[model samples]
Target: MNKVIKIENGTKQGVLNFLEHLITTDKISGVLTLRKINEKGICDYGFISDAKELKFADPFAPVMPINAAQTLSSLTPTTKPIAAIIKPCELRGFVERVKRVQGSMKNVLLISYTCGGVLPLNTFQGDGSEKIIADYYNAISKGETPGSIRPTCKACEYFVPMMADITIPLLGNSESESECSLIMNSEFAIQISKEFQCEIITSELDSKIIDKVLAVRISEKEKLYNKTKVTKDGLDELVNIFGKCVGCHGCSRVCPICYCVMCDFESHNFDYNIEIFETELEQKGALRLPPDTVFFQIGRLAHMSFSCVGCGQCEDVCPANIPVATIFKKVGEATAGLFDYIPGKDLEEAIPVMIFKEEEFEEIGK
Candidate 1:
């Protein structure tokens, strides 16, 4: 059964009040949410222990510098319980990592809100003030989509969280409304509700609003997919897509799924002798300075696309502007679809490549 908890004020102040209540009431040890790094508007995850620090908390910030999953994975199996405010994509990425044993959900409370997407870091010019965040939230609550949101976010299919302990619904709520609705999805959420003395009432999700948004997003995703589709299955096409790669490996570094401590690309095998480079130069008449650009990209696709959550961090950090996220999302969708698998949907489901059945993929074998 679903229960609704009314926030006395709007969501901005209501959330801050709730967080303070959680800390003062000894419900959580700390809070993990976004805070400004400096006077600039740049925001990153921070662990707050003092209620006074809630002034810096901007859980609804319209920017994602790095996926919070990586940060959450690093802090998991923690000594004490903590509350984490994360975006839907970040939560999904964390779910995938947890299944891989890279993260733990033992003592963490996952709280999420309706995401209105985010803008690129370069475009952000605010000072991470509460008013700025509140204004943006109010605008989004009024059904206005900002023009500065990222392309990937505009076409995102998973803007609303599904597996969170608590969810704050920003859609279908009028800006004039004094209270915000909280969706309790877990027993932990119910406990929190009781502790806060929030009224528990039966309520249904606004499925029509969600469906309308998803339909537009799906259409946009198809358009982007077609535009980026490879016409031929050949090395030449891949080269065109990845030819400008400088081999900085920034994409792998930011990827939550590329968890290998030592990647094959950085292994001793790629450390060739000068004579080998001379031989390649003689044979091909020309050689790219650092070879295996195609190999590295294809290797990553094979290794991580099965669990790719399409956070776009890979493309965000790419120096060459290779549209890495687009390619990865396209490939990831196709590869995962073949097995009827949705990464992060179920923790018990095994990774496709790690398990096999005689009946599976029989057509391919034949």
Candidate 2:
């Protein structure tokens, strides 16, 4: 049976109060959530053990400095239960990490939201940041997508998370009504609510409102893909797009799927030998300072195309402003479609590359 609970103390405060109650009453040992670090609106994930410290924690903050999934990879398989508040996309990324054995879901109570997307890091840290945040919540209150959000977020269809222990309905909710709704998904969520002594109401989200949001995102995704897609014959176009790369590897660093500690692209294998440089210079008359920029992008794409979650962290950090997320999203969608796979959707579903089927792609082999 589906269970819902409404906290009547406004959206952010109500959620915080619930979390505080859990901590004070010893429901969970700690919480892994986004906490504001300073007045500048800079924030990162904080693993908080004390209920009093949650004053700095803002689970609804519209800024994502890093996907919390990568952090979970480093901090999980815990000895005690930890409640993690993250966006739907971040939870999906965590599932991908867990499947790869980079993290464990042993004692995690995942709390996600009907996401309204997030601001790009630049905009979040820039001038009038407060106005941007205020405007963000305003859009949510009105059941409209915000104009100022990460490009990848505008196109994301998976804003409503699956596989969460609890889900907070922010997208289709009216915060002015002074009620915060929680969709208790897993048994753990129900148990926690009962332990906290909260009334469990049976209600569901308004599908009409959610569908309206989905329609806008789906339409935005099509337009984004068309704008950034690299065609089979568009090598020049590909170069024109990725050619601005500074070889910083920021995209890989922020990618949840690129879990390799030692990337071959940064290894001695790709080093510039004097002879190879001379040969390349002789042939092309001019060599780009950092050679194989395009090669690196394509190679990384091949490595993660099946698992890319379209978090937009890559483009967020890219100095060149390449639509790295969009390109990867387009390719990832195509590759994952081949196997009818959606990464991070199910814990039991094996990654297509990790499992072998004798009859799989039989027509191609024939």
Candidate 3:
């Protein structure tokens, strides 16, 4: 059986209240989520042991390179009966990673929000700052899709959650009249629903509304892919777009899945021999001062393509205003499609990079 409930006006407030009840009544430990601004305007992650610290749940909280999955996996000794709030992308990564680790899913509660996509760091419609999202939240609690959101999001097909204990649909359907509606999936969610004892009502969703939103996303994606070709065209576009880039590399450094303790791209492998350098310098008028702009990006893509969550942090941290996330998502999608894989959708699905099958692509292999 399934239980669906809708909050009249205090969806966030209700969620916070539930978390508090879970901690006090249920005796759970902590809740993990993307950090948001608290009352003091301090930027940090939301961790609630007791009720006083629970901020209004903002699934789009920023400056977070590490998510519940990565953070949960890294704990020396994992904790149990904890609740984690994550976006669709982050939850998928956690599910996939936990399947492999197995130890990560012992007693965790998953709280997922229906994502409408997020804004890129360097390019957005607000006042040239990240706070525009928070400001938008304050102004319109409806969670307007960020103006400078990535094309991948506009086109992304993976909007639904398959593995969540409890799922919150942000893009409303028939219950547009209610605040936000909760759709319970797993038995864990049902248990939570029974424990909370909130109003039990069947969730009535508007399939047409959901379809319309997905159609718009798919349409935007096709147009984006149609607009971009292979890496060559992408490079010229990047050079043009990021002409002012200072090679800070903050994007990759802050990304959650760019997870090489030591990246080979930054290693001495690319340090050209003095003779080769002189020859190339004389042959061409001059090489770009940072020699491996293309190489750097390609290396990162190859490393994490199968696992790329499309968090938009690369473009966020770029000094040159480059659309790094867009390009990465395009490449990641192409490569993932080649493997017939979608990151974060299924925990049982094989990872393209870490695992392989012999007869996977006979047409391409031949």
Candidate 4:
């Protein structure tokens, strides 16, 4: 059964207080959430063992320097259970990783909030003041799209946490009000409530408002996909789009689904001998130094596009300012759509490539 808990204190403080309560009650070994790293307004993940550290917790901060999914993957096969407050995209990415055996969900409790989109890391570094962050949250709560939000976030349709144990609903809530409803979506959440002293109320979610927001977001996502759609007409278009790739492999590095310990592109196979380089030069008149840019991109797309969550971390870290996220998201949508699948939608739904069905993809056989 779903349960709602109302917080009389401010929502931000309510979240912190709840985290503290969990720690004090020994419900979790630690809490993983964002904390201010310095006075420069920088914030990153903080794994807090003590309740007092909740003072620095800022789970609602509209900035994602790194996808916490990769961080969670790094902590897999963990020794102790912990609670993690994550964004919708991060939760989705983690779910995908769990299915691939890159992470474990056995001892983790997911606490997710309605995401209002986030600013680019560079933009946040420039002006991530308290007032700006507060104003952004206020705008989103009011169903307004502030211009500072990243394009990837603006186009994101999965802004609500569907797979979370506990979800904090912020939509349709008054901006002036300090409190919002906490929804318990899983038995674990109900169990936690029984142990904690918070009042649990039975209330239905405002599905109408959520649906309206989702419709708008889906429309935006379609527009984005159309704008970035790739074609198989020719390699000229592909080369033009990826012409500036300097082979830094930033996209692969930030991709949560790119879990290979040693990628083929990074292997010595890509390294050419002097004689081979001379042969290539003789055939093509001249070759680009550090060849096979398009090869590397297509290789990555084939390898990981099925699980791409479009978090924009790849584009965020790219030195060449390539629209890596847009390309990947567009391709991922088509690839996943081919199997009538949605990445990170469910834990039990086997990956399309991993499962074979006689009735599946009959069009291909035809």
> How do the residues 76-176 of candidate 1 rate in per-residue lDDT, one tens digit apiece?
97877789999888898888888889889878889987777777665564545445555666656765555566667766888788688888877545742
Q: Model 3 off-target regions past 4 Å?
A: 5-9, 34-43, 55-72, 75-77, 96-103, 120-152, 173-180, 192-194, 202-205, 226-245, 271-285, 363-366
Best by lDDT: 2
Candidate 1 whole-model C-alpha lDDT, 0 to 1: 0.80
Task: Tell how far residue 248 is off in model 3, in angstroms.
Answer: 2.7
Candidate 4: where is the Cα deviation over 4 Å? 128-132, 175-177, 229-233, 362-366
Model 2 bad stretches (over 4 Å): none
TM-score of 1: 0.91
Superposed model 1: Cα runs more than 4 Å off:
37-40, 125-139, 229-233
Q: After superposition, how far is residue 198 of candidate 3 from its true place, in Å?
A: 2.3
Taking the tens digit of each residue's C-alpha lDDT, what string does model 4 give over 1-366? 368877777777887888888888888888889998777778888789899878888787788878898888887767767889988899989999999999998778899987878887887767546666667877877776656777778788888886899888765556425775678888877777576666778885567767877887788777776776455446887888788889899889878788788999999988788999999989999888668888998988898888888888888888888888888888888888888888787888888788888776567855
- Name the Cα RMSD for model 4: 2.1
- Candidates 2 and 3 compared: the better one by TM-score is 2
Top TM-score model: 2
| Model 3: per-residue Cα lDDT over 2-79, one tens digit each | 568656645565566677778777547877765455443334455667656665454444334444556655541345
TM-score of every model?
0.91, 0.96, 0.80, 0.93
Query: Order the candidates by lDDT, highest first — what do you get?
Result: 2, 4, 1, 3
Full-model lDDT, candidate 3: 0.64
